[model samples]
Target: MCYVMSYIRMAMCVILFLTLFTGMCVADSKGNLALNGMAVQSSLGHPQGDAQNAVDGNRDSDYKKESCTFTKTEFNPWWRVDLGNVYTVSNVTITNRGDCCKERLRGAQIRIGNKLDNNGNNNELAATILTAPNGTQTFSFESVNGRYVNIFLPGNDEILTLCEVEVFAEKKLLINI
Candidate 1:
């Protein structure tokens, strides 16, 4: 009789512990609720899920496994996501991509908020267009502010190669809003 009673008490303790743990888990998932106010965008191969993925695409960790190369060209071209908001970039991660893929890199550009193309104005190029290094580079941007971002790819006569180019930034809250 004592053994059975002890087992029942143990079972009760487990059930209580599980219930409390579940509550804590819920709070952890919804640790902080953010009110939508600023732009949050990215093209790090996938949707914006974390700060580390600021710039998007495959990186050294996984690129070798998949024979697929990240590519940019004049035809399909590279892209810059508007993130639906503006942010102050803190870091940038560029993953080595492409064996040059089916397409090639002409050149690539990235820019923060500026009225270049949107104004129907031409001749003015992107404010922050970048040249992919011969090798691979992980770069960062700090102390700059802008809203719209631009990415330009002026295809090299040969093809350019890349896996992913990611930008990391801290979301800025607009007081005017």
Candidate 2:
């Protein structure tokens, strides 16, 4: 009877560990709420490089081919997205143009908040990319609540080209204790 009780206790410990571990894993997966098909805008009005191309679910990375959006070289060139409703954002993924001139994305600041004032530049600073990447990059920051996600490139002679922009957020879950 003692051996039987010991076996039961061991089994219970294993079950408890698995339960806790599984819950933790699930928590991370629940934070990536897809923000596809959302509205996108840019400071420059390129006929072929419209802001909407960034969120069209394509990461073509070829700006010359009109696969991404491009802003006219200017001071503080910016791009923004509207999530329609406010959300608890977990991260922002940006696909940079890989064909050429990837360095144009350097020193880009990502801002997130509900405010639309000042072209969304007044929003909260989420993260910044020190080195411009040639491919897809994910910028993860502490979860923030916002409806507008804007990317600003500070300085003159800079153009903003984006192949794609993906916003992930935490989904609200209701739990009854």
Candidate 3:
């Protein structure tokens, strides 16, 4: 009986370990190609309102209460994300602040390419948002292949507040070892 009980306990421990570590083992199993929670940056950012907030998987627009980036009002403020590798981007979804000032996202240009010149301004233009609505907005365009995705707001004095930015592309399957 003692040997049987010990075997049962060992089996239980293995099960628990697998339950906790399975998520880590297959973390990239998402069927879609959206590079969520990846390396991101911006020209201007605050301590609390860091650039990663836009990709932190949170859509809460209130920067004070939630995770979001606030750039100093300046000419051509921009935010960008490196997709790690070049991908055939299908579309990009941006979430605007629902609390206030959703109009600040207007006239923003979404550019995608491998070029880093002039803060990715030289990249091919994917889409230009004329009037961005509140909440999440998905901008679809022809598949553009690039390693970097940039969102630029051109103006003399304007702020760019992005709650969330989701980039979707053609999904790539990974083989788990």
Candidate 4:
């Protein structure tokens, strides 16, 4: 009887562990939250380079393809996305222009938070683009809670362009006791 009880207890423990593990995996697989979000920029560089292009689920680096966003040369040009609701963002993936002038994104700041002050540019500084890349780059850091993600280029006569901006996050799970 004792042996049967111990075996049953061990089996129950394993089952519980598997259940929790599966939940966590499901939460993390929610995919890119920014795909359904809304995007905006400080100024439009061209009609084809609208802010909405960044979240249109296309990562084409060529600005001519109209899949990237562009801002006119100005001080502190910024692009932002509203994620609809607050979420614990895990990482952000940014695709830079590949056709030319990929260096325009250098020194860009990635800020995340719920505050709309300064058009969400005053949010928590999550990361910075230290180097320009011709392809996609993913920036991961400690999870940040926010409904807005802003990419601010702080400098004089700076132009901000983004081929794609993908935001990935784990959904908050509520467990009932």
The TM-score of predicted model 3 comes to 0.74
Question: Can you rank all candidates by TM-score, best first?
Answer: 4, 2, 3, 1
Local distance difference test scores for all models? 0.39, 0.78, 0.76, 0.87
lDDT of 1 by residue, 106-125 (tens): 24545455343632122223
Across 1-177, the per-residue lDDT of candidate 2 in tens digits comes to 999999999999886776666432122335333335555555554788888778877778987777688898787888888776567787899999998889988999999888989889889999999999869999999987777889888898789888888888776421111
Off by over 4 Å in 2: 1-42, 173-177
Q: Per-residue alpha-carbon lDDT of model 4 for 64-110, expressed as tens digits?
A: 99899989999899999998766788799999999999999999999
Judging by lDDT against the true structure, name the best candidate: 4
How close is every model to the real structure, measured as TM-score? 0.42, 0.74, 0.74, 0.81
Give candidate 4's TM-score.
0.81
lDDT measured at residue 72 in model 1 versus the true structure, 0 to 100: 24
Q: Which lDDT value does model 2 have at 75?
A: 78
Worst lDDT 10-window in candidate 1: 25-34
Model 1 misplaced stretches (Cα beyond 4 Å): 1-57, 60-76, 98-107, 114-131, 134-136, 155-161, 170-176
Tens-place lDDT per residue, model 3, 1-177, is 999999999998886776576522212323224335454444555677677778777778787866677788788888888776666787898988888888889999999988999888779999998997789889999988777888888888888888888888756422222
Q: Supply the TM-score for candidate 2.
A: 0.74
Candidate 4 stretches with Cα past 4 Å from truth are 1-29, 173-177
* After superposition, candidate 3 runs with Cα above 4 Å error: 1-42, 172-177
User: Number of clashes in model 1?
Assistant: 26
